[model samples]
Structure formats: C-alpha cells, structure tokens
Target: MLLKSIRYSLDELIYLLNQLSDKGYSKSCESLGNETIGEHTRHIIEMFQCLENSYDLGILNYGNRERNDQIETEIEFAKQCVVEIRTGLKSENKILYLEHVIGGLAIRIQSSYYRELLYNLENCIHHQTLIKVAVLKFQNIAVIENSGIADSTSEYRN
Candidate 1:
C-alpha cells in the first residue's frame, strides 16, 4: 500500500509536467529569485534518485544528490528519470542507514527503504505545490484537481 502511494504521487508529478509547455517549464519566477519550475522538479526527482542510487550501498546520503542539469532543462528527460525511479522503488524493502552531516558532525541513523520512499513522496508533493504556483502564475494553466496536494489535504476538502 505504501509503495503504491509513492508510485501514484510520482505519476501525478509526471502528468503535471507533461501539461507544461516548454516556455512554462523553463520560465523563472522572480518571486523565487528567478528559479525555474524545472529546477524544482529536478530537485524533487534527484531526491528519489539519490535513494535509488544508494539503496545497494545500504547508506543513504541526501547531500550526494546528482543535481542533473539535463533534468532541469528537458521535461522528457525528467519523465524518464521518474520511470527509472519508479522501477527502483518497487524493490523489496530493506534496512538502510541514513547519514546526515550537521555542524561538522556526521550522524548515522538506522532507516528502511519504505520510510525513505514515503519521504520522497511527501517531498515531491511539496515541490509540486511550488510548480503548480508557477504554472498558474506564468503559464495561466490550471493544474489537475489536487495534482500536487497530499491525500489528507484532498480528503479534507471533500
């Protein structure tokens, strides 16, 4: 059930990205210090990518994100990355270690792949909210109802 929810959130993002025009996808928002929607999308996708890439290593470090620029410039490329991530997320759950560096100190915490997948799902929804704002303000496009909203929020609305 959890994995299915994560996949659904990712698919929702892909649907929203497909609706964006090239100009809309690449346009920077002055309110966001001229950061493009594509950049936000790239960041979100990279989070998932980081998890997938480090799954085999048993150590997850979010600071090691790929930050691929191609994903920021090309909608199709981002979509492909999503497909790869979805496939990676389907693997059996396993225990993993999360490494975080704070104030010059390294902290290691035990975690599971399922938990990280949930984190990525929530992270994508938050970023998609920003992307939805850009789509509305710059492109005047209406996002599919509840496309980027969390299920709890959507349920409250109904």
Candidate 2:
C-alpha cells in the first residue's frame, strides 16, 4: 500500500515536472512569476527528501523551511529527487516513527510512517496548489486547470 501510494505521488510529480519543463522559465509575466517553475518543483521534492532522510536517520528536522536557492528546470532536480525517494523506500523499514510537533495541541509527538506519508502528501499538495495560484495570479496564466488531490496533473500549459 505504501509503495503504491508513493508511486502514485511520484507519477503525479512527474507529470508536474514535465509541464514545468515544457513551460520552461518565464521571464516577466507568463512563466512562473518571480519564482521559476524549477524553484517550486525543487521545493516540493526537497520536502519529501527531507522526510525520507529523517526516516532513515530516525531524527526528524523541525520547522517548515526551504534551504535551496531557485533552480532551473534544465537540471531536472525534481525527477532526481523522486528517483532517490524510490530507492529509499525499497528498504525493509516498514514502520517509521516520525517525530513532529503538533501545532494546534502544542505538543511533540511520534507519528507512524502511514501518518507521515499522508500528512506529507497533504502538505505538499497544498504548497503545490499555492505555487500554481501564485503563477496564475502573477502571470495571468492558468498553468493548471484545477488544484485537487484527485487531479494528478501539474503545471498544464494553457
């Protein structure tokens, strides 16, 4: 189940990456706003990579912060990250206790791999949609027709 879920996400991410690559980088008002498509792509993959690293080391990194600079799609960084994620998941570790802080309850907690993956998917999708909206708002281009978990495509050029 975990593999299937992650693979589904990987496929969605690949579609998004392809769209971003097709669009290339916008200069002023129709590409990707001030943040290039690569930037958004890298951010999403980086988030997942971090989670995978934390799971491997059994030490979760707190705070939702992005560290890398803006990237260009020529590097295909997002795809590389997805490949790494796939490799990591092949391990035998089925149960991962992800340590995270509960914001609303104001408590630290240890969550299972299933919860972690689900939450990560939700959070990443929200951020991805936000990036899509930002592009639409700044460039006046609807890169994506809709923003929903059910819609797997990303960065549709239209």
Candidate 3:
C-alpha cells in the first residue's frame, strides 16, 4: 500500500516533468523564495537515493547525500532518477539505523526501512506542492492533477 502511494506520487512528478523544457524545469520560482524546480526535484530524488544506498549498509545517513547539480539542471537525468527510485524500492521491511550528525557527533537511532520510506514519501509531497506552485507560474504548462496532495487529505476530500 505504501509503495503504491509512493509510485503514484512519482508518476505524477514524471508527468509534470514531461510537460516542461529544460529551461522551465530549472527556472527559479519566485514563490519558492527563488529556488528552482530542479533543485526541489534533486532534493527529493537524493533523499530516496540516500535511503536506497544506505539500505544495504544498514545505516542511513542523509547528511552524506550527494548534491548532484546535473540532477537539478538536466530534466532527462532528473526523470531517470525518479524512474530509478520507482524501480529500486523494495517491499521487504527491515531494521535500520538512522544516523544523525549533530555538533560533530553521530547519533544513531533505531528505525525501519518502511518508516524511512514513508518520510521520503511525505518529503516528495511537500516538495511537489512547491513545484506545483512554480509550474503554475508558467502559463504554458497545464495543471497537474494531484501532483502535490497528501493521500490522507485526498481521501478525506473524497
């Protein structure tokens, strides 16, 4: 059920990307405090990439996530990243350690893969909401349905 929700969100993002040019994808949004859509896209993808990379290691460290500029500037690469995440997610839940670095110290907390995935799902929704606002500014792009809404909220509306 969680995977389905994540995939649905990812599909919505991809559909939105399909409607944009590289310039439009990377253009900074005034509403987002001048942050570009590509930046938000990269941040969302990198969080999932961090989770996927850390799964085998049994330790999750989002602080060590890669900030790839290409993922922000290149729409096709960004789309490829979303596709990779969509395909790479597994259904098997497992015990994991979330590593947080604070004041030069590493704090390890017990967590599950599913929990982290849920966090990533919410992260995607929040960023997509901002992305939706930015995309809306472009008069050329059509509205993307449910591109940024939360599942529970959507259910409530229905």
What are the lDDT scores of the predictions, listed in order? 0.85, 0.57, 0.93
Instruction: Name the candidate that leads on TM-score.
Output: 3
Query: TM-score of each candidate?
Result: 0.91, 0.60, 0.97
Report the lDDT tens digits of candidate 2 across residue range 1-158: 66676666666656555554335532333434466656666666776766776775555554544555444444465567667776676434445554555665434456655666666666667656655654554433444444534334443432
**lDDT at 119, model 2:** 67
Q: Provide the clash count, candidate 1.
A: 0
Error of 1 at 98 (Å): 0.6
What lDDT would candidate 3 get against the real structure?
A: 0.93
TM-score rank order:
3, 1, 2
Report the Cα lDDT for candidate 2.
0.57
Better candidate by TM-score, 2 or 3: 3
Sorting all predicted structures by lDDT, with the top scorer first, yields 3, 1, 2
